[model samples]
Target: MDRYCRRAGALALAVTAATATGALAQDYVIGVAVANSGGLAPFSQPAYDGFKFCVDEMNASGGIAGKHPIRLEVRDTRSEISEAVKFAQEFVDIGVNFIVAPPDGDPTMAMGQITSPAQIPTMTFAGTAPILTSVGEYVFGSYPADNQQAAVLGAYAAELGYKTAFLLKSPDAAYTQFGPAYFGTVFEANGGQVVGEASFTMNQPDFSAIVTTIQALNPPPDVIMTSAWEPDFPAFIKALRGAGVTIPVMGADVLDTPTVRGLGEVVEGVVHTSGGYPDPGSAHAEFNARFEAATGKVADTNYVVNGCDILGMIDAAVQAAGTTDAAAVGQALAALPETEGIMSSYTFAGTDRMPMRSVVLARIEGGEKVIIRREMADPATMPAP
Candidate 1:
């Protein structure tokens, strides 16, 4: 089956229950709060689908540790802070063993306000903001920290011989703000300079003004970098390309969605960081194949693997703790040794709650995602979160 069709099939299934093949064991209830029909839906939906797929697979294999089944209690936040908080409160009231928070910073923070105090181990599948972990010791971020992603792209830009850059900043979230700043920091350390910068907001209808601003520069920058995603990214790229600004653009992993890729020729040559490549024989490839076979659909977004990795991390933490106690699991998660996941091998880097993993540099070539390189960024060189 095609990717979209397979995704639809998988998403159509109940998020609450998974079919198991053996006698049930002590089941772990995981509360999931994600945006299903809002701006965050593009990423969260696929991630939730991957989460569900993992749960189903685990249950079929006799659940976590081959003895405990997983019960998913899901609620769509609709991309609203109030809704996210409401669902989080509901989960806390019911005392779910763990929580899978929405991927966005605001919603995740709102959810954390509830989950953290209740001492539940809450994981945000793609919340890259470093501050998200500060909500409490119970909160953990599943994706690489934003600064790590920016540093990777920044050093990459310098290595590609880009001497000057024009940054496109965004005030919509910390991911956009700190991401670009760290990019500039690393770029400058490598003999590059940020010649200029412009601020943008999310869902801005027109990027012509930004495009014109870039065009107005006496000598265009060697590269353009941003932490923009979704509507902003597509609209900006369209405007940038339409205005004939062919400078290479660099971004973080959020740009690896179908929306940007669907732009095809317009997004060609744009490079960004990602999780891992699902090459034919690798673990990622096997997981992707399993997802397709189980759902009879293909995963549309690479973020699907983020979901699988979230569960993988949880399973490892649970095993390490030897119990499902939230506090113990949280500690185990932070102390987890380097572990393999569908997307990449990840570690909490010794209690930061940010997974230290290899960054996959990818580019859009001929309207398809192509790998440029994969390397672990040196923490010593990364800007402070």
Candidate 2:
């Protein structure tokens, strides 16, 4: 009986040791809440692919600090504001250490409340300036601010000698409203006149009414600027051409997509402002390559770049913190300098959680969105008035 008791005790101890070893090798889960499986799914999928590629590479490389393997817990927010809030709550409940969001200002704004309280550092890929800086130190944005794009668009329009410009946008989307509104304001402030301003609904397939309004503006504006989505651009351009309005059409970063390239001649003269260039040889070349391989498509837009940079930023923060602790990660992210990323080098400026002031202007030339100018907001080139 004494010998049997000793063997049983030894077996129990070995089981506990094996269980503890398995627990020690478990990975740290990072939650990604984007507009996957929704209207923006096409764009978000590429972003998610970029993020996954990053996480896969990290895990293959022995992960952060060589202690924990990284795992992603992705949630599809459906591009709805309420769904985003629910996903954020779910992420909090799951005790996820990191969160990534899509390029929707409203959704990110809703998520800020949950993440801020949980003290989890978030990286948003949206261009919404208000929501981005509003989240305080808890959130950082990989995409350039909406207002920065406005400044770049204004400068590009002025350079093209567009003395009279007409602004058209979708009233429902923050991107549609804020982008054109701010661009118009900056353009007008820079000695250009906004001759006509118009709004449309996102679901509106026909832009005949808006095009008619634009065309009826006595001496038609030299340029017609819009903040429409990629899918809507081709149709809107066709409507404009059908309405016999042949002025140069310009837009925001929404025009920088593979779908836009399919528009061919319709998008030829259009110029748009973006933070990233589509060329694979650009800053995020390897990232783009990985994303393309995973998705069976090229990373030819800002969404993928945003995802790559967000993950890259998180990787840097984890390395800096030396652990996956949320608060420590936030502090490490805040302390990050201008590190070169797959998109651009982001430097935290003062108390602002937004990226450093760098913007690039891209124009559709010969059926491709080509980089025209790269500008950094410095003492000489201050943030737009």
> Which one is best on TM-score?
1
What TM-score goes with each of the models?
A: 0.92, 0.88
Best by lDDT: 1
Q: In model 2, where do residues sit more than 4 Å from their true spots?
A: 1-26, 278-283, 293-295, 378-385
Evaluate model 1: give its lDDT. Answer: 0.86
Q: Tens digit of lDDT per residue, candidate 2, span 1-385?
A: 9999999999989888976765456577788886767667776777776777667777777765555788788878888878888888898898888888767766776787788779988777654554454865687777777677777788778878889989887778777877787888778878999988888877687888888888788898999888888567777898888777789988876677878877777777778777776455665677677677776877777777677677778878888888889888988888888888777778764536777746778777787767787876442232432
Model 2 whole-model lDDT (C-alpha atoms): 0.76
So what's the TM-score on candidate 1?
0.92
Clashing pairs in 1: 6-297
Tens-digit per-residue lDDT, 184-249, candidate 1 = 999999999999999998988999999999999989899999989988999999999999989999
